[model samples]
Target: MKGQGKRSICVSLVALTFASALAACSSNSSSGTQNGTAGTAAGTTADASKEHRTLTVEVFDRGKPGQPDLNNNFWTKYINDNFGKQFNATVNFVSVPRAQEVDKLNVLMASGQAPDISFTYTQGVVYNYVQQGGLAELDSVLKQYGPTLTKYLGDDVLKYGKFNGKQFSIPGKRTVLAGSNTFIRKDWLDKLGLPVPTTPEQFYDTMVAFKEKNPGNVSGVIPYGFSLQPSNPGLNYIPEAFKPSSLTEEQFATLQPQSIWLTNWNMPGFDKAVQYMNKMYNAGLISPNFATDKDGKLLDADISNGKVGAFQTNWDGPYRTAPGTYANLAKNVPGAQLIPIDPWQNDAGKHPKNVYSPNGMYIIIPKTSKNVDLAIQYLNWMADPKVTLFLQNGQEGVDYNMVNDVPKQTGTTNSGDKMMTVANNLDYDILSNGIELGDQQKNTAAISAGYPGYEKDVENALKVGMVDSYTTYYYSLPNAADAKSNTELKNLSAQMLAKLIVAKPAEVDSLYKTLVQQYMSQGGQAVQDEYIKNYKAQNGK
Candidate 1:
């Protein structure tokens, strides 16, 4: 009833805005629909009038098996049937490979051929385009066509889209901000007569015990699961816990966190973290081939096989059904009690970690598009609470059933109405990610109800992950040094950290010193200096 009320209001707003826009149109130039194809350049001025135009939106193609094509799925058709029909536009979806999205997007952007609606996780790439005058300024367009979008995203999330006092993008809202949540085998703890670890030291002891005792009774039991993906090392899982308690805001801001600071090698006590990791490596308490576990799928296998004792990942890592870590573990090792826990405490006795900044992908309309108005409208349509609920949960009693207030997923075997296997078809819900049911209680309840057998565990994982989480420093302005060298610096950091983690315990301090010097020499100092300078200018601190 609450969602329904909100939905009616939003739907009215959408219709009213569309009517007003359609009434004031100057022309109607028609372009036929292009389904799931690459975007071509289109005029931004006269064609933006009231036109039956082909609006090409970009979507990720993971090439997953059994899933519908990204272009012609039930969801895509639903989008066209609803939003596309309303605007008299043919909505075409362009597929960008998920693994090489940035590279593919770059190729498309450089030739002025990006999709009408495109987005990326990296702000630096967007910033580069902004500096080059390659993006459209959406402030006036958004105000005229995207009133509901403005209210839905609000200033908080909208700020990420703004560049040089102009709204250049719409940042997708992230419901849960927590970055990394750690999961441990409760059954193993029960067998070993050990408590859930509460401190870093205790966690280390627990890992040592896990290694020695083999509490799971599995051969090659990895006490800690880790990954060294060059692009996404994921700091919150490891070195960030060693972040000094006395870390100043200035120091934190200078850490170059947007992309390259993935490993957190720049943190004050980073060497100590590496040393601790080295200790884990020597004791054989960590994954033996972590350096090779790029993309984290290998770590997932270890987790599913019940070989991992404890691991850290995105808040809902183990819960998702595909590559279903929790579900697989349940079937493979019966009584496998994997539960979320917060054990790795920082120096301040806080489980401090970098949470998301209430935003996921940076949604942008490239300057090459004539469909800025349509683009804004399409996003607003998705932002409508009704559209959001239907997209996420699907039709009641068909794909899901309402138990209390939340929609719990049921059998979705009906091919015509089946939901995308990807947790919530997140790729299509371009304006938002993670479930947001208007309130925190409903959100938690919905998450609990969705994953039937591991309902409570997933709920606790989310709550625990959020306990001491905080968003990383966000600069309204882009850093040039970051744009230029983030890829190089991140790769370097991942490689250096991986090596340091495998180095002998005694060699850690000196090796870390050498790596820091090398890192600083190779544009790291420039990034830090520029960051600190900008920090002071912005904060006046």
Candidate 2:
């Protein structure tokens, strides 16, 4: 299976001039009918004028247990009114659970019920579909119908969509590229006369002090709050400090998980990290129910109730914004102060974090779709700057007001919750050219409007330069072993890590070794071998 050779083939192409190609193509005409013939163009116009084609789009549904309908909300009607009427197309959105996107799309594709446009963050899912010929080749389709999208995404970014010399999908561009960082309660530190930690030992000591002193209303305070859930595990970045630099070419290629390459539990420093976590658990410094708080609700509540002293979260959400952990905590516990800090120093004594890929989601057309051109047209329309603004901020006067040329959201509801009511348009905003990238002054003003006087905190948090995780290259090639074994390996790793953190101090080392060996034997070795082979071939090493 090592020399199956499916992974060895590479595609290299000179940048095709999009403007000339687009200028030559007939306007609003689908792929094959681009030539201006009276019969073809007239016939297409007549058909479109009489009856509009139906386009089904897959969007992420993130409603709570008993909230309003996520799919059929105000944004659905907005899309129908604005896009459908303009394009002579009827728009329908299919809701896929955000957490179970891969599983649900697999079922839909298998049953020939997949939408015209489907998207995923996982590279393997798209690879699997392309390998099975389940995706539509978008190069010709895009050239004929997607001038706006081509112009917006450009040639360099679109290269990410190419596989085996064909464009199988459109790669969404990411506006930001920094991993999550640790945040601590500055008020607590001040109350206890403690300074912010800069090293691993200092961080450990701080947690111990927080546990012992109980700075703010000491009773029931958790020094460190974390969750072991697969999706958003707590303290996920702690082990990076212990990561070993010396690695073989193969080891480096397969070192970290897909979309994450800066650090890994399989590396040398993981044992020490786990042991430190175990020590915290034993000393009651970490939350007691961390192993079972899979969805992070408990931790969220703890942070809000002023029970958590420190936690790790994405740069923007938890620290610098409102309707978030910091905002909620401030409302519940007066004078709560949260500050972002890059305190994890690796073996090299430097703060290193994973660099986010510029690619956000892989948007694809299904082979079974009847209206591929219409789908491409819809995406192109969305890539328009005005449309992107409207989708992101809603009606200017109603949902937001322009301040310093930035659309700052208005009303009592904060930006985070307001997004849900607006059909979470950001998810369906396939182009991802939101206000975050458009205007710096407006972006800062909008963030400040959300969480008054915290714009500087958000700005400071973005100052840390991130290191590349190399996920772009990893996602380009197919890894057969990963398709077969990555899920199991991740599950095993999460479970074992939890066990290692809560086990007896003496049992920690043995537990780590046993789990690592088990992980390798179960399928990690095969996955690593395939990645190593692909990396060497791609890099000509």
Candidate 3:
């Protein structure tokens, strides 16, 4: 908290002047009370408020089947502790697994048992909730109590939470990176007397060198591999060298004249990328069953077997593989270390074309809440830097310790592990921005020690990050008919890329042209027109 107060004061003075704003109001309560007889449901109540009320919240829980803690974990307890004190209303934790979260909440919405706050994902769900008239527009409420959020979440992102100009949900911001950085076995690189790659050609050479020199050791290793599932694409691990398909390019094209990039995924670079992979595949440099295996099994088998020489992977790596998964690997292969190979190392700042996904997750406010203002008050508190830090780092000595002027966690707690505990114990959630503002170092130290460094690296990487040219709102349209079409186009493009990569080199252009035609036919042109019009309208073009 060294320069915290100063930073806040400077920020406020130049901007909202939070102190004056708060001082303009009386020390009147920001609390919510239960219904004893009738209710002071909205934010109009004066001081001298008292009652026992509970606000139900719906959330995703990471727990085994039939576990009570899944729904009401330790983290939920901690969150309620703070909210209950501030609001005088209990915050209830409603749990559902990831797969069932939206579906279950939909059911709850239909039954009128929907919690006061629910986190969701797709724009479809958020828009659906809004269309149902089941959400509150927090314009007034946020104006009164959300200065911190107003500052941090910014305007456009906040507007993204709106439906037809009215804010219906809170923006659940989530951090994004182009693709998981490619990690190579550095030890092998040293043994082969080769420098780290700094271009696509160099990277291919390095992989080829490793395969040639190491022989059987790297025979089954994948030089360039990733989870290629239709559902997700393990989006975070896409190579920056593939920068042609970036969101920035898309946005630029919306305004200026530029060739359609991602639409035509069969470009020379893509074909070349595939050709490199083909070499890996035929030379036995990649895992034999890569295409057939699911994401988890593919990673688990490759990393554990010490056969993955280089791969597109998240910095956190595969530490969370199920029980006995990583442990089994440790027993079988001791020297199989995962070394971070910055994609820049391979392509040397040559980013591959890709788009930024939206920067947030989903948030829903139930229509049943007694005091929407009170709820907003508490959530605004979540936007407070102090509170964000606490939620991320935990309460001082209890969750972490300060060392060398850095906040670090202590004991058997890690960020992800602690997140599970904290979510259940404290009723907390994740946000996209402010990863560094919170005691992030402390949180990461306990778990992967790699977290802090990775955070910084990713932050640095964003300087060149391409914001998606398309608005997530396009994905939230009335029937989401536009999004469905884009999805089809994207899928067709990916399939063509895959086929081109796996096919004979000569067949690349023909297949790419076919995919491009498929894109135009699948409402790609409509999507482009809509995206261009909307983008200009939003940006005042």
Candidate 4:
């Protein structure tokens, strides 16, 4: 239940595991990643990179097999040589379990056992620390020591870290912010003589066609891939086209957020959206047991096995090679064509999807830390253009090669320093998310190259996902009601939503009403009301 608002805890795990999924929601992209290396090249502070004795930063133990140690690895050694020795400080990395980072960091900060620099994606963690006055105010330190850092992160991204005007965290800058994209089997469409779906009605008819035609010729064809997890991107977005577009600011603020955790049953068109989904489910247009595929493995497996005709997933998912959904599909089914499409549009004629906020992790320097100055200096150094480039692509011609001026990653290197386990070596470049070329065109080309043959598909997905996309809203103050009841309420939302989706047509409305009623009684109303209060109080602050 950590970080459910904006991008949920599941979304973070999606980034850590199926990085392709992160590509859709990320401005933390690959191209502009190196842009930070130049970091506007403005180190205006008198002693920006001053000498210090020691510095500590937290890194995630991503639990990937054969992955280098988070604390000490080739990348860490490179950092030590390039940045650490120059500052006369030994940079130490403290590893926190990725899946349990928020909980672990809470304990660490409370016990004064945290690193000099740490971060969390969970807003509740930041709120807890701010409430306890355990986080250092970074406003002055950033102005005095992190000019380039501030410029790169910009006002919009940095604002996410401010609470009541106190800058308690440094939000990592993400340059692009696209989100989920839906894909259809181009070959199936051709076989069935159906053009791409345009409206919600057309889209549903298309799914029905996908089922009735048996174009894939599989024993049990899955017209659409789905997962019932609260974090499901399709579950979060595909139906969002049904949300009313003319919501006033206050209503949007109160309801749009935390939709994944609390469910947007109260939203005007949400019930209709769920009812349509129930119709699809009863007709067997979706995976029969989608509820069991919490981690997306089973659904992904279905897609890779060439049984799923159409589906939605994090942008660039099918294009990537890791899980290689597209690759496996190509190998299994000859002439299978999976292409990105923005089919469902609301009455306003827009494909409403959730784009990422232009921020990544909320990095902090705890008040308990003695190395505040050094920590700020270290982070500032990280924002350096050259440093950002190194952290992202490693040595040119070793870790990567220049293709049309883009750094193309060459697999594992002979030396450890140039090698990487995670794609884009995101672990090493904690400050940046995906690749960043100088501009969108270059960025698209760079990302396209990463996907090999599916370059066009990747580009299409990115473009389609961005059309009329709404960036996740960040609250300046945390909702205590949400933080307190989110765990219980999130599970309830997921359970009831599954029932609403799978129930008979006649039961859909009654089930949805029950969901909203039970949700309100079981702490939903408190969360909603407290969130509104916080939103109104912090409206223009």
Candidate 5:
């Protein structure tokens, strides 16, 4: 294979160059193993006599203003001390800003400076790379060097990596697949003598009542705080109830059921959803100037300061982890409480919510990489049970201690922060998507451990068993039309949605129609046609 030849050349070059430089750094060190071969354990040994090749992996920076040195974090050192040394490889961690991932990666690829192993959560980006033939075929590489990874991920999950019957990437396995839901102030509901909302009408009435009677004594409360920013449009689930129960065969063929921006807005009930949002805006039921909350700081502040009555968030977000929204709100408002509610009842009188896809981000090796074999070896090592346990849970004594075979965090004042500083570098874990323990019971228990007080809520969420989007199966495939016009169409759609939400009641209908027409003309139609073709070809529909 091309990767094998490259690996040989790379190893020879590195050995020749580093022979003198690393003369004192022998494989006999404490980190080294007897045979100098990578082990399944967390701390394994590597051949010190062999020169170590440098392999770079990309990680998301997450844009913390003052937190620099993402490339040299504790986790980076941990990997270097353990995995890198064990494989006779010097792993270089490259930090790509989370917000500018696509743009930065595009530039890196163009400049031939992309990391050996890169990943992205956006399927469109993966499709674009595959279409451009910029990614290496991984089937042979996995067979040659990734037996452990193959065994761990299994064929069913690995199918997500196949494009055009060739493996161009590896799909990460997600353990918990629950999506976002609406969380409301339970204390306010009790104070106002109201029941939990199950219908759209009931939800709207509840928000209005929250505005009318401020239960928490906080002035200027946002009844339904939402972020209208392009990236974090928090209102996607609110409008799901308005979606058509079923699509026409042609519409179904043309649309991707999972896409919130592309085909979702084009659905039958979308116009009504926008109209409903506009009504909420007119009534001051939603946050004013929501479009300006680009990073969700305002929403977070509102939730923390007891100024938000209700909002949608991940199932474990509000209450889970330290300094949590639920904890903060509780401190500020003496009796504040939060609980999840499925507020959108569909036409059939059943509450419908989006469920997360079982597969997660794609991990791929660029064709330009010189260390493809090293990258595969690193991922395979990461899939090992001991190594995975360390990366996900942290050092046994310092971060967590096993209780009845389940790891639990030790009670330390800064334990959460300490664990977060090291374990939050999720981009490092390239194999398992979510927290995987290789046991369903243990995996569920591990996930619940993160949320201290919301065990039942988390359990109930897993039981929801909502429907996933149609695009779940097509994530690894490329959509040429989308690659060309997705960004433009996304910006246009966001602007139009923002306008419709705040537009005068009389002007909304006309504006929405105009926006949809513009969207269809400006590449949306092309995208739909391409999706229809791909869907039929893939599903034999």
Candidate 6:
């Protein structure tokens, strides 16, 4: 719940771009991240060394671990020395926590202390700030200072950040994929002599059997672990299990009996999945406290210890701990492997399409800033691939080295400054950032180093996966009301389904009917209509 749309509560910020006329007056700033470094002498037309102005930036790594030191962060320092040396200006930096970012930004905007360049994510804050005229338009800036930027920001990338046909925000260089599929512990499946589960029913049976058997020096397993609690999007993974083949293209599609009004609870697969869950609960397969607890304690601690058999997670592996969940598990448990169970991975009846989302993370220029051009110039400098690589890894000889043109780390360095002391580093933000679809191959080495084919496996799964049905329609409702209503609807549906799982087969039908009525009353129909309208509008059909 906390990870879902809750960030919107603190997302009301001010934004607007300054007039285009000022862009011509602004000169390029030195690439130097510090106060007085010069930029590169020999560079492209947009080179910072040829221009002069101070650029301010806002990045998210204020107190976080594994970041650049304020003084030695390669990019910052490079800009300070190299860029400043060439252009005679320096870069100013601001840092904030990821969770409270929106709120902090809002406060800054209200206090009239907005930064020149700021990072704005979706969840209402960016749009709120833009609507309030607190952010700047970057069309002129991009045209004048960023011809390379113009080339990379293709049409698809430009569509999402547009509001009413005018572009207010530029998509960052990073692209984010949709939700994950069900990840099963392969070792448990092999121990139970079970094959990879292709259907929800088969998946349910495996979880049940795993709980019943209690193999591998562990007691009974927690069948089907999840982090879905109050108002969390993690529960979104559930509906996929019971999705009707006909509505596979549209999980939130209308079921064609508005007169009868069959809700999601009554859908063909809906009741069955819930009934299975209830059975698991009553039989002690599922933890009884699952409904009340959502911190993922049951999944993270219990499953990580090899006590739980199966859980829903992203393709990358245990989302709670990066690389640790998958890496450590494989290292500790013999034959431990992550298996992705697709709700529709093998369903030939449906054309698979993963969910597509607009860019949540963006770099923007606040309207209140004194030096808009300087900020844009700094961002432009950061966008360079060479700069990106430098930020991510470190200096060439110190942090990392190119062996046959492939970047390899010489030694581990936690801070960018420290890394820079040794070798050149990769700037993930600069190298792999994008608002649209990105080439996984570009970041292949880094992602693999950390996740080990996790990205590719997930993408392959998504090729046959189902995207969330609500993403497109979500924007129509008032921001607050939309988030709250969806959360409540999903929670009620989960609750009802959980109950039906335990009820007698005879009692299942009636329970499902009751759920249908409740769903309709909760504006499920209106929600469906919104999706249909938006989908058509997007396709121009």
Displacement of residue 525 (Cα, Å) in model 2 is: 2.3
Q: Which of 1 and 6 is the better model by lDDT?
A: 1
- Tell me how many clashing residue pairs each candidate has: 0, 0, 44, 17, 1, 61
For model 4, how does the per-residue alpha-carbon lDDT over 245-294 read when each residue is reduced to its tens digit?
89887777787665332366667787877887788899899999788777
Top candidate when judged by TM-score against the true structure: 4
User: What TM-score quantifies how close candidate 3 is to the native fold?
Assistant: 0.71
Residues 77-195, model 6: lDDT tens digits: 56566545444566655655656777777776656655566666653566676667767776776667665555555655555556545556666643444444567777777877889
Question: lDDT of candidate 6 vs native?
Answer: 0.52
Relative to the unseen true structure, what is the C-alpha lDDT of residue 371 in candidate 6, on a scale of 0 to 100? 68
TM-score, cand. 4: 0.87
Tens digits of per-residue lDDT, candidate 2, 215-273, equal 87856899998877754232456766776656564564566544332215565566777
Candidate 4 lDDT: 0.72
Candidate 5 lDDT by residue in tens digits, 118-189: 887666566566776778888887887888888888887788788888988888877766666578899999
Candidate 1 per-residue lDDT, tens place, 34-85, comes to: 2322121112222335657778888898766666666776677667766666
RMSD of 1: 9.0
Q: Worst lDDT window (10 residues) for model 6?
A: 254-263
Segments of candidate 3 deviating more than 4 angstroms: 1-46, 50-52, 65-81, 175-179, 215-222, 233-285, 318-336, 343-349, 352-358, 385-400, 404-427, 430-479, 482-495, 519-530
**Structure candidate 1, residue pairs in collision:** none
Of candidate 5, the 10-residue stretch with the lowest lDDT total is 1-10
